[model samples]
Target: MSATREDVGGTPLPPGWAQPAHQPDAFEISTTTFEQRATETMARPFARRAIANATDHAAALTTARFVGIDHDALRDKARQIRAHAIANLPDYLDQWIDAAEAHGTIVHYAADESEARRIVAQICRDEAVTRVVKSKSMASEEVSLNSALEAIGIDIYETDLGEFVVQAMGDRPGHVIAPILHRTKDEVHALFSTMAGRELPNEAEALTAFARDRLRHAFLTADAGISGGNFLIAETGEVLLVTNEGNGRLTTALPKIHIALVGIEKIVPRRRDLAVLLPLLTGHGTGQQITTYVTMVAGPRREQEPDGPERMHVVLLDAGRSALLGGEFEEALHCIRCGACQNVCPVYRQVGGHAYGWVYGGPIGAVLTPLFRGQVEGGELAHATTLCGACDDVCPVKIPLHDLLLGLRRRRDEEGCVPRSEQLAFALWGQVWSRPLLYRASTAVARGSLRVIARDGVLSAKAPLLRRWTAGRDLVVGRRRS
Candidate 1:
């Protein structure tokens, strides 16, 4: 997992990229198949309806928000900016490192997940940090940073309304933007009630106040704050964090020490690039013109400053990202973590994020899971989609999701990761299809067999060969009586 240092990362702070951080057993890989997981989620009608309604509404808002503008032109410009930043990533990182260090930010580099965990944990220990307040950070989830901090006997509180619920329930995030998209308000009410010892009101506003009251103590007493960066400005050496909640600002400003675990691919060449990138990010992610709180920090609190953390550290994490650079899959690096593709993906809407069995999900997840995790563990995810181009259409950075997914499928085959049974079936189909006579004969025989099995123009019962395929879908043979 050693990264190519020349291009992939910055210099380390200390105890350089070598400590073995604890890895959770079967961290993101599901114990069951995608079908099994999807079935389980589907069985929960509340969760299914919650996810569907939320996504459809978000997709609608996204369409409506961009109605008066040249949305395609904005997406194209954003794509170009992201493409340029990624293409010249190393140079931008070098400039950022120099500028950040000058601004009094201590920058650390982690080549992979284990190192990322080790780096942040070591920082906490070194600072003698006891309690920590945190904002939403997908990178932290990717490396399982909270688990690492807990292992060292530090108390960590998730301040974001949704993420706090996820942490309290010991559940993985269900969506990239809305971590609790699959959870209903009733479910949250129940959990909060149990926590309160007295039944709390089932209203959203009351529940929010309860969470705020509890988290305020954490903010005041915490020694450290941790967050993920939305964008890294290379020219000014600033970490840009956008959120609808004030937690991001509070998390960074209130704590004595602040640490940010940001992916290296998140870097942009200049602060001006945000003019092109931020609107697309906000519009596509939440369908808002802009996030409520936009915090940009170039360094820790200065001597003259009245607020902010005393010391700031930025951990530039590679974690399997640099491997994709200069390769066929590099375009994936251009993603802004908007989760727009997820909102429009039919498969994601059906099963939600958990079924993908990873930190990320939806069309981007299908491509990234196989690439970040190995094909042996995540290859099946590539086949989880219907090859629909809806994700491509909705992507803010214009990631060719369909092509990336297809590439993974092709790679899986080339690497012999696919099951032998499927290989044989496809091989047999290819052989027969190559011969026109055999193809015609096979189709005729299949049609004749189906007609016999058909009852009232439908194959109503599960048959031996097609049982799995027909379980949720109906196979209609002749014209309907109606």
Candidate 2:
């Protein structure tokens, strides 16, 4: 096999399949077929019910939180604050580093995932870490940090309940805030039973208590704690963690070494900026005025301090963020990981987060994944949205998600990542629509073709070029073309 052939993804190819050298492998091709997966996901009654309930409750609560408040003005201010931060990110980063160092925090810069993981592994080795507890951090997921540490014999425990459930089940997170939302109670009971070596009750309280018991030990005994920073304040050199669970507090406070893996964009210029961001993050994220826990670790515990980490480390991960600065989608950096976009997204509620096939999901995923992972690998995600602008309205930081998705599509076409057939089809469409005579001729042909396919005044799905459209519903051809 040639190099390109050997480089093809793990997805099994059909007999006699021959992909072009430039074409993405079967895995990438499969992601582009999100429509097919979406159909499968939407067919599940449980998934539909669970997602509908979650999004509905979230939407209602978030809307209620904004009552009597000028939500738009807050969004505008958020945009202004983020734009200024992005423009002056370098200066803020340096100031943040100097202040953090002064506060006795050890800060490390990782240019890529490998470096970030290496930093964590080295910290584990230095500490002789046998067990580690983790708070929810998507940055850790981006780097596959758990597996990296596991390879070196470090036992990493996910302390967050949702995270722990997904980890125990050997699955990836389905949603940012609610990882196991798609899972049924029975499925969770079965998973926990396997771990407990007994049959467990399929009840929420029971499962939570079981998990808390398991995590409590991990928190106290852990040699180190790994977390993701929600916001990094440059002025105070503090790393903020916002969570609805107590695990975030315990994981950072109890451990001898606390390692925070954060993206550079998480930095805000001043401490006061958080006053504006916290309410927006919590209100839009979980429909609460404030989360259950909001913890800030300025640095390692000092000799004067009674309880905290002996050493503190912040791994500022680039992972393709620096390149986005001053680019078309630079506003994506403003995301607070609030997950509001996914909650309001029509497509996400149907297909769920897994269909996006990345750490991030929904509108933000459609924009960031493609940019960070490259147009060839993540470009297909751009088509996952309906361009409904619901994501825009719900975004606290006011990132233009729909516009960014369009930009990704344009980038795909410009990079020739779009399939040749699709390009040809659109080219022909443009030619036909641009000319009146050709347009009329094409419509006449289509009408005649539809008539042939029509039965009882509804078109059959067997019609070529109309199968996808007619798959789930009947389409009646209109006599008049406007």
Candidate 3:
């Protein structure tokens, strides 16, 4: 089935994985540029619009009411639960395998992204699938699954509304919970009109209706369905999917073959843990009693069921998660994708997702990127945050996000990954500070230099290597007294 303009409208294509401009070797350069870009972006009308939606007073009040329990106590309990699960991951993995296999589900293990892609591609080729419908899965994004599938001549359709928009626009997700939050209504209207070959309304209801009508056909005609698991229950061998949209239900149930891709860290010891998490996710993400759809698929449909898939496959991916599990950074595995960090983050609130130059954004991205790609390729992303404790405050699983970012920074420093220029600057600063006379002389020179550069108490002229800093804001110089 071909995707209609209505179906693909307003959604950009998935973003190609690439490094962003402003390559900074040292934390100081990276931090400075990050601050500059974040400040500029937040000032834009578009960024303000997106922030309004997330920080809506009504929504915040509703969420506060639902999670009426003490925030600190709940966070502590959730932290302990995740800690226990991570500590005993191996045992849970074994249990998950045994239980899932018992229910006739085929399980595959992948060591990395390439292997994971190969395994999923082989499955599609073996099944002779040409088209697949998929639910939203960050694991899929991490592995670039759609590109891998397309490389093998398979057409994949994203069933989630936000993901579908992103897939069509060919852009990476901007936020975990609200992927298209960076876009304005006007931009979406223009995109939809181009795809639909006609004018489309900018109203939310009209846009949603157009997408629903377009995706309905893909659901009925797809040969296979793919999804990412929110939780893997070891006790019952069930994979749980939590979504605010009903599209997940159709994506998983309507196809002939069903496949789930999950990171190994998603495993939970029992089904009951969901009791605490379901409310937490809703409270932290969208403030609902429950997501619109919560699905638990144990295996393929039984003889009694007439409408479910016949074959079920689960691919459990390691992809650096195993190495991180036993390491000091293991706390990152507790992430539940509630996106509380991004919402509360000053940096993310300003610059949005594109500045981070990765699939994940905000505090979680800082830690995950470095770990996934190693400090050499993704070390710069680690310095994107201000080390604020807001992320820690809102995390349902209570990951110590700021501490993790600091740890990554230390690792980056130890590896000598920092730029030579920044290193030299710090070394010089240290030398001057060691002697009182040298420090005083340096301060005197700085004061004189500021006077020379100042124009009416503001330094507006672009200084050498300081052009970016002066581009937007004025730097005021101190006036001399008689």
Candidate 4:
């Protein structure tokens, strides 16, 4: 992918420019089809096991400590803030543009991934930069920025510990918050030893020290720093970087040039919004009052500052997101990347992120992949969820994730994206139900078929399509003729 370096200028698309396609036929299969298939096909059983072990199910079930804080009120406020920002996106974008410019930061807008990568590469070329340090930024991931930079022979180091581990292993992050959540201690020890060119202890502190020693050198020598913005404040042109690790601060401050890659929807109207969001994120995520670091950078170091970057750049990427702003999927933009949805997601809990075959996973991934990549490439992702309401309930912004998953399934079906076997099965069932006599006769036949398959009152036959349902559980067929 190449990045583009263009100014943000153009008429916004008409509201609902590309309505998400609807495919009613795709919903015939149960929502578990994709996840079930993924579980059987995934190559890394150790990774899946690691993820299951890391996320404590019983701990997640413990009641969140609201403690005089009104979760409902906070959610309402957050929703309003996101809704307002999206509604006036163009205006706030302009405000952000002006303020960033006023603060001596150059802002670039890219319409797609290639364009975005080209722009970043060009910036690196212009600066004659050979090395860069990066903070955790999903926008950079979205644009595949690291690969693009590496293609140009630029050494880019991911500073976040989890990101660093995944980068060293040449694996995409499995979880947004914990990129290395899928790897066990032994795997991490192996990866670290390989990367460090020596054996390192399997302890977390030792692994961290190894990464820190390696990255500290890069920080001092890097020509530029690249980061993903958690929240972009339109009122001040300030970008918020939230992290449990201190690397975000170091990367942004040490480099000569600091470039932030942010999606347009990340903008909030004011800084005060951070008050509610930061605590909520910490509490819901790792059960902390605050992360180790929360840096709000407005621009590069000024003439008076003793230590900071000399230049700053903010790239606003609108790769298929603006198109989703006012449509049925608009609520998706309200996502805070808290991973709460993923944490509680039954599908995600089972098969994990790679199974979705996309970057974003769980409820959010189901909604986003299809919308961002269009129905054909990403539409199949909708079938990964179990329509469980857990994701929606834990969402800090109150996005209706379950309903959106169902809607996407409906859209995919209408678009004829469903499998042929599924279509045939549902069609045959529909035909049978449409005729009362045939429906009764089919019921009778089904009963007879059940009797043939049943053993000791339980149907344990390993039928082709029904094998998945019966694999680990007993299914008892009703004997009543009705």
lDDT leader: 1
TM-scores for candidates 1 onward, in order: 0.91, 0.88, 0.87, 0.85
**Order of models, best TM-score first:** 1, 2, 3, 4
The reply for model 1, stretches above 4 Å from the true place, is 1-28, 435-437, 444-467, 473-482
Give all candidate RMSDs, comma-separated: 7.9, 8.3, 5.2, 9.4
Taking the tens digit of each residue's C-alpha lDDT, what string does model 1 give over 108-174?
A: 9999999999999999989889888899999998888887887787777889999988887777889
Model 1 poorest 10 in a row by lDDT: 1-10
Residues 1-482 of candidate 4 have per-residue lDDT tens digits of 22111110122223321121332122122234464546653446776666666555422532355556787898888888888888899999999889989989889989987888988998889877778889998778777788788778777778888887777666667787878877777887986675555688889899888778767877877889999998889999898898888889988899899888899999888889888877776766676778889999988898878899888888889998889877888888888887777777767766777566556777898888889878876788887777879888888788899889999999999999989999999999999899999999997887888777777778774644467667645788785843
Name the runs in model 2 displaced over 4 angstroms.
Answer: 1-40, 437-482
Candidate scoring better on TM-score of 1 and 2: 1
Candidate order by decreasing lDDT: 1, 2, 3, 4
lDDT of each: 0.87, 0.82, 0.78, 0.77
**Which pairs clash in the backbone of model 1?**
none
Model 1 lDDT, residue 201, Cα: 94
- Model 2 per-residue lDDT tens digits across residues 1-482: 11221122222223222212233221222354567666766667798779878888888899999999999999888888888898899999998999899999999989998899999899888877877889999999888888788778766778889888777666667778888877888888876675665777889899888878777867767889999999989998899998888888887789899999999999898888877898999998889999999998889988877798999999999989999999898999989898889889988987887777778878998888888888776888898888999999889999999899999988888888878999899999999999999999998898888877777667766656777777645687776545
